[model samples]
Target: MNNNNALLIIDMQQEDGFVLEHFDSTVNNIAALLDTARQQRVPVIYTRHINQADGSDMPRGEPRAADGGPSSYRAGTRQVEILERLAPRADELIVDKGRYSAFHRTDLDARLKALRVETLIVSGVLTDVCVLSSVLDAFALGYHVRLVSDACTTTTLAGHYSSLLIMANWVYALEILTCAQCLHALCDRAYVSLAPQQPDQFAHQPHELENTIARLHSHLVRTQE
Candidate 1:
């Protein structure tokens, strides 16, 4: 809602490594967020997971093509491009990275600093990988984050919710929200969010994952405005 907030969309490329859960709905959700952000003049930043065209910058152990190029998101390829529907406008920021976290070896932090951004509203793909790592790094960089839980997905629903719970438990300055709630917040309206009141609030055993995630979701909607 404040000018200090930014919409950080991470790795929403055309890469097809995994058939992500709820990918279509997630894209629609993010598109809605983007539209609203543009309407409100909120700064929108995007991260692309670009690897070297020749695999020179590929991280150790990353898969490679027969020509020794990075298997995915290789530079100059269509797959590394952001989804056409979610493409950035000229004024929007785009951060390209070779690593999972957008902040890793990138100028994202410095750019956010120049913009005077204090909070990040995060969305995008691979909930257990890039999204997870980026959210954690955002927290570490002292940026308060609002995670749009359903606007990002992983290969499985389990991985999606598990990563969310991990952030809820330890990312102390986080507020786990849905796409609707985030929109409400952006518009300066009353909205319900599942921010942790204490550390380890969503702590649960492996087998209790679903129950824990359900409990978290219940809190988000129970007090809806």
Candidate 2:
């Protein structure tokens, strides 16, 4: 995934917190990642899981509940709210899902295709379930997937770490990276874009301007040296 990519944060809602408490740390790192994406003008999409009442479980709906527990996670519920740590921008898109995969029963794929997004940086809860499902679908659809290893979690330590190992080994198109590495790649790309190329195109306006500014900085450095 290059600069023209988008970051997909899935099931990063309060409901998942009921199952995993480590979301606090993961969410903080995710906030940093989101901030970096915003600074680089990369699109960010947040997915919230919604469940209908029918004697379902907390997430997928099982068949044992008296007070309509499933409906508690419906759209706009406090549990489904995006965590405050990763504040979504006014223009950022938020998709509501009823199933494990964010793309299922959601316009996520169509929206990504419309934006010409080819690479997806996937991060979120239920590492073995939702995250894995979404990442696998992304690979099937030919989108390069980068999993933010630290920004995902499961209820238990084994489930969380094992998911990373599996994806790293078997997922060819998927790369496992930390938030910092991804941010560095984006920063490197920005520097590459600022470097001079096709001198004629920049010459008339600010070709000399770059050199002039560089020379002034060089002279100041010499004085200090």
What local distance difference test score does each model get? 0.90, 0.70
Candidate 2 lDDT tens digits, 1-225: 334689999877766435674777888878888888888888899998877555343544343346665644565468778777776779999998877888887899999998889889888888988998898788788888877766888887657655654555456676566666666655653211111123222222334554543443343234322
Please give the TM-score that candidate 1 achieves against the real structure. Answer: 0.96
Compared with the true structure, model 2 gives a TM-score of 0.75
| Structure candidate 2, residue pairs in collision | 56-61, 56-62, 57-61, 57-62
* RMSD of model 1 against the true structure: 1.4
Over the stretch 165-219, how does candidate 1's per-residue lDDT look in tens digits?
8898899999988899999888888888888889898889888978998887677
lDDT of 1: 0.90
TM-scores, all models, native as reference: 0.96, 0.75
